[model samples]
Target chain A: MQRSNIYILVFSAVMTVLIGGAMSLTSVLLKPAQDKQVELDTKKKILGAVMDISTFDKPEEILNLYKARVKSVVVDIEGEIIATDDKGNPLIAEKVNAQKNHKIDREERLYPIYMILNELDPNVVEAYVFPMFGLGLWDWISGYVALESDLNTVKGVAFDHKGETPGLGARITEEKVRNRYKENKKIFSDAGNLESITMVKGEGITGLSMHEVDGLSGATITAKGVNKMLKEYLGCYQSFILNTRGLNGIAIN
Target chain B: MSAEATVVEKELKVEKKSAEPFLSKRRKNIVTDPLSDDNPITIQVLGICSALAVTVKLEPTLVMSIAVVFVIVFANLIISLMRNLIPGRIRIIVQLAVVATLVTLVSEFLKAYSYDMYKVLGAYVGLIITNCIVMGRLEAFAMANKPYDSILDGLGSGFGYAWIILTVAFFRELLGSGSIFDFKIFEAIGWATFPTNGLMVDSIGAFVVLGILIWIQRSKSGYVEH
Candidate 1:
C-alpha cells in the first residue's frame, strides 16, 4: 500500500459521489420543461389536423393561430349540446327523459373537441372533432379525423402511435397513407356506408365506400385495428352529428 | 471495509486517496487492442444495437458515431488523468461517473443547439454511454495511461470505432436519403445548402446504400476479407 495509492482512492470516490448527484439533480430540475415541451408538441399536432396551416411549423405559432379559429367543447353522447363549463345542469332539460346516463355500460360521460369558426356575424362553421382509436402492427394506435359540416367528408386527419417498426409498418403517419382518409373520404353517411375501412391483401381499393383506407402491406393487424376504432367511435358521435346537421339543413344521419 | 483499509489507514493515517498509477500500460493496451483482429465491434461484437438502429439513415449514424467518438476519447482521458487518484475498490464507479457526466453534457448540447438532429437521435444520444467502446477503453486502458497518452488512446480506439461506423453511415445515409446529413443533394431544401443537388428520399435509397457499401468493402483492399 503506497502512500500515493491511498490518496487516489479517496479522490475517485469523492468525484463519483459529486458527479452522480449533480447529474441526477439536473435531470430532475429539467424534467418539467421537457414534459411541457412534449405536451405542447402534441397540442400543436392536434390543432394542425383540424385546420390547415402550411405556413406555421412551430408549436407556439400554431397555438397562437389556433387561438383565433378554434373553440373546444365537451359534449354528451346524445343530440343535446352541453355547456362549455358543464355547470348549469347534471341532466338535459328538454330531452331529460330521452337522454340516458344511468346505464353503466352506456355511460354518458365522454370528452370530445369541437371546432367552431364565426364566418359571419351570425353564421358559423361548427363541427365536432373526435378521436379514432384503432390497432396497428404492434400496439393500440389512435388518431384525430375531422369532418366537414356534412359529418361524412373528412376535413383533415392526423394519426400517431405507440410502437411500430420504423420503415415497414410505421409508414401509416406518412402523407400518402393518411391522404386516403383525408381526401373527402366519407366515414359516415345516411347508413354506415363503410362499415369499416378496408384492410385488404393488396392495394388499389376501388369504390367500396368513400371512407375505406387500404391497409399497409404486411401490416394487416394494424390496419384492422384502425378500421375497428373508426367504426365504433364514429358511431358514438352519430347523434350529435345528426342534430347539428339537421339544424343547419346539412342532411346528416 | 477491510483489513487493507485499516492497515493503509494505520500506516499513512490518510483522509482521501486517488486512483492507482496504471497510465503507461493502459495507453498501449487500448491503442493496440482495437486495431488488431480482436476489435470490439468486429471480433468481440459489442455495440451492434446502435449499429442497427442508427444505420437506417446516414446522418443519424454519423451523428451517433461522432458522439461515441467524443465520449470515448474525453472519458478515457479524464478517467486516465484521475486514475492515479482513484480508490482501488471504487475505481469502476469513478470511471463511470466521469464518463456519464461527459455524455450528458454532450447530449444536452446536441439537444439545445440542433433540435432537428436531436429529434432524429432521440434516445440514441444518451445510449452513447452504454456504448461498450467507452467502458472498454476506461476499464482496459484509460485507467492506467497518463492523461495525454490515455486521451490519445481513448481517441484512437474511438477513431477505430468511428471509422467503421461513419463508413457505414456514409453509405446508408447517402443511398437511403439520396443525400448525406438529411440534405437532398439534388434539390436544395431552399437556397444555400445543398442548393441544386437533391437525392430522392425513399426506402429503396437505404437498400441501395447498404448494397453499395457491401460492394465497396468487398472490392477494396485485403481489409475486406476480414
Candidate 2:
C-alpha cells in the first residue's frame, strides 16, 4: 500500500498501547485515595444525619466531633450491649478501619449509634437515637434520627437515599425536607403509641398525630418506603425507646 | 505542451471555484467564526447529555461547564497542533486519548477539592468524554484550523452549551427546590418561622420544572419541533 497507509497502521498501534497503559495506571494510582474518599463520605453522611454539625470546616474536625459526640457499640438481639466486636474481627473498639479488614454486617453485629448535641445547651434533654432503613422508589432509604425525651419533639434527624431521582425524591437531602423532622415533631399518636411515620394520602397531614407527616404527593411510594423502613428498623430498638420513655415520664411528671 | 498547459489551468480554476473563499481565507478565518456563524451546540447540537443532568443545580453546572470548556479548548488546540503529524488512520484514537486524559485529571481535582459539588455531578463528570461537543469541535473545526482559531471555536461552542444548560437548570432548580443554589428562595406555607418563603419542595416541584423547561426551550427556540 501507500506510505500514508503504513504510517496510519503504525500510529494506530501506538495510540492503542498508550490509552491502555493510561487506564490501568489510573486505576492503580487512584485506588487508595478513591477508597478513602468513599469511606470519609459515608461517615459524613451517617454523622451529619445524627450529629448537630452544621458547619465544621475540616474532615479532621468532623472525625473529632464524631469521636467526641457519637458513641457506637454492638448490641445483641435482646438489647444487650457488647463492647467487643460481635463476630470476632478486631481493629479498635469503636473505630472502623477499612484498610486492615472488613467489619461484619450490622444485622450480624447489631450496631447502635448514639449522637449527642452540646451538653451545655440547657434545652437539651434525654436523647433518643434510632436506626431507620427501608425500600425506596428505586433502592434503600436509610439513616438515623435523634429526638428529644418528649418523643413527640425532634432534636435532629439525618437521612441518606440511594438510587432516587435527583431534584425529585432526592430532595430528601435538602435541609428543608430533612430538617422538617425538627420541632412540632410527630413520631407517635395522641394515643401515645409508636406508629411508623405515615404518608397521609388525603389533604396533606395537618394536626395528625406525631405518627404522620405529609409525604411528597407524586413520590408517595418513595415516601411510604421511607416510612416503612424507619418504622421496621427502629422497631429493633423498641425496648430501649419504650423503657426510656417509661422511666423519663415518671421522673419528669 | 499546449494541451498540458490548458489542462493545468482548468484544474486550478475547478479547485478554486469549488473550495469557495473558505479554503483560501484560512489565515483570517482562524481568528474568528466560532462566535456565531459556526456556533457548536446551538447550530451544531453536539452536547446535551450533561446539559440534561447538571443544569438541575447552578453551582455544579457552573463547575461542569468550566471544566468542559477547559477540556474542549485545550483538546482542540492540542489536537490541531499535532494534526499534520498524526497518522490519518489513527486520528480518532489520538483524539480520544488526549480528551480522556484531560477528563480524568479534572475528575480527580473535583474529587479532591470540591467533593460536595462532585457528589452532585456524580458520573456526569466522567461522561464528559462522550459529550459530542468536544469531539465535534476537535474533528470538524479544530483539525483543519490554526491553533488560535481552534481555541476560539472551543470557547464559543462551550459557551453555547453552557448558557443553554444554565438557563435550563436555573429554571429547574428555581421551580423545583424553590431555591437557588441550595438557598431557600421560597418557603412553603405554614412551614417556617417567617412565612416569607414559598415551599415548592414536593414531588410536583420536579415535574413543574421539567414542564417549564420543555415548554420554554421548545416554543421559543423552535426546538423539539414536531
Candidate 3:
C-alpha cells in the first residue's frame, strides 16, 4: 500500500527534531573541551611569535614554557590597563577573542598583549606579542606578531587562516612567510616614525630596510591584507608603545 | 516506496543465513572488493576532492580516513534501518540529513579532542557530507541491504578512499617535506643536504600521485575503464 503524505511529513518532522536535538546536545556537551583546545592553541600561537616553537614536540612543554616566560595583559587603545585578576595578572588573554575584537570601534576594543620575559631577568620584558586579525581574500586570517624589547624590530610572527587558497594565500601559515618578519622593524621607519611593516609583493628589496618585507609570491591580495591588519593594529597600539618606550628612557620622534 | 524500485531490488541475491560464519563470502566481498577492483578512488573516482585536499600530510590524512569511516559506517547503518520508512521522493533528503548530522558530530569530536588535525583538515571535514561515496552507497547499497551488510559496504568504501588518500599523502609528505608523519627522515639520516621537492606539497602533487596510483592499480588489476 502507498504511504500517505501525512506519514512522510510526520516522519520528516520527527527526524528533524531528533537530529537537531542530538546535534545541539553534542555541541553543548563538547563546548568545554573545544574551548579548552582553542585556549591551548591560542596560547601556543602567542608563544610562537616570540620564540621558535618548532622544537616543542610536547603540549605540556608548550604550556609550561608559556606560564614560565609569558604574562598576559589587556589594554585599551590609549595604552591604559583596563582589567586584571586578583593576583594583578591580566585576565587570561586567550579568553578574549581577537577576531571579535577586530570588529567594532578600535578605541572600545580590548587588545591583548603577551609579554615575553627575559630568561635571566624574569621581571624584564623581552618582547610584546600582539594578536592580529583581518580579512583575507576569502575569510578571516589571524596571527601573532611580536615586537622586540626595543619595541621597534619584529621578533617573530605566527599566522593562521580560515579559507585562503591552499597553494597561494594559505602560504601565510608557512614558516617561510613568518620568518620573513624577523628583525624587520614595524614601528620605527628610516624617518623615525611609527610606520608599520608593509609587504612588498614585487622584488628589489635588496637594501636592508626595517619597514618592509617581501611578500608571498602568489598571494598578493593576502599579503596586502596582512599589511593592512598590521598597520591598523600597530596604529592602535601606538600610544601604549610610546608610553612603554618613554618609560624605558627612549626619546620618541 | 515504488513498485518499479522493488522490482529492480529482487535481481540481487540476499544470502540465506544458516550456520554460516560471521564473515561470509558475500560479506567478505562487501568489505574487500572496494580495496581492489571495486576501489572507490581508483576505480569509481569518488571523494577525490578530500583526497587532494587533506593528503598533503600523512597525519591529517590518517585522521580524515578514520573520520570518513566513522561517518560512512554510521550513516549507512542509519539509512539502512530507515530504508523501509523513507518515501522514495524524499530519500535523498533523508540521506543528506543523516550524513550531515553524522559529519557534524564527527567534526565536533575532532574539534574537541584533535584540534590540530581539525584545523589542518579545516573545511574539508564538513565537506564530507557532500562526498558522493556516502550518498552513493546510501542509495545504491544501504537502501536495499540489511544494516550489517550496509555497514560493511560503508567500511569497504571508506577504507578504499582512505588508502588511496593515505598513499597520496605518504608520497606528498615524504617528497614535499622530506618527512614521513613529520619524522624528518632525510634530516635524521644525515641526508639533510638533499633538496626536498617543493611540488609534492601542493594540491597538484596530490593529483599527480593519485593519477599514477590509479594507473598502477588499474594496470595491475587489469581493470581498464574502456
The most accurate candidate by TM-score is 3
Candidate 2: the clashing residue pairs are A49-A158, A186-A210, B55-B169, B186-B198, B187-B197, B187-B198, B187-B199, B188-B198, B188-B199
Global fold similarity of model 3 (TM-score): 0.89
Best by lDDT: 3
Ordered from best to worst DockQ, the candidate numbers read 3, 2, 1
Candidate 1 lDDT tens digits, B1-226: 6998889886664333233244456556656666544455654556765665566566666777788878888888777877776666767767777777988976666654554456566566777878877888889887776677777677667766666666666665554445666666545544344322122233444444434544554454234535
Q: What is the alpha-carbon interface RMSD for each candidate?
A: 5.0, 4.6, 1.7
- Model 2, A1-253: lDDT tens per residue? 2247768777778766876787668767877777667657755765666555668777888877655555555454456665666476642423543212113443444546464545566334446565556667877666667766665456666666656665556656667667666636666656656665665653345675555665664567777777776776556665566655676663322
Better of 1 and 2 by TM-score: 2
Q: Candidate 1 i-RMS (Å)? A: 5.0
Candidate 3: tens digits of C-alpha lDDT, residues B1-226: 6987766665333333444578999899999999989999999999988888888789988998998999999999999998999988788999999999999998999999988777777888999999999999999999999899999999999999888898999999999989999899999999988788778877888889999999999999998776
Query: What is candidate 2's lDDT per residue for B85-139, written digit by digit as tens?
Result: 7866667878988999889878876776676666676667888999988988888
DockQ of 2: 0.24
Clashes of 2: 9
TM-score-sorted candidate list, best first = 3, 2, 1
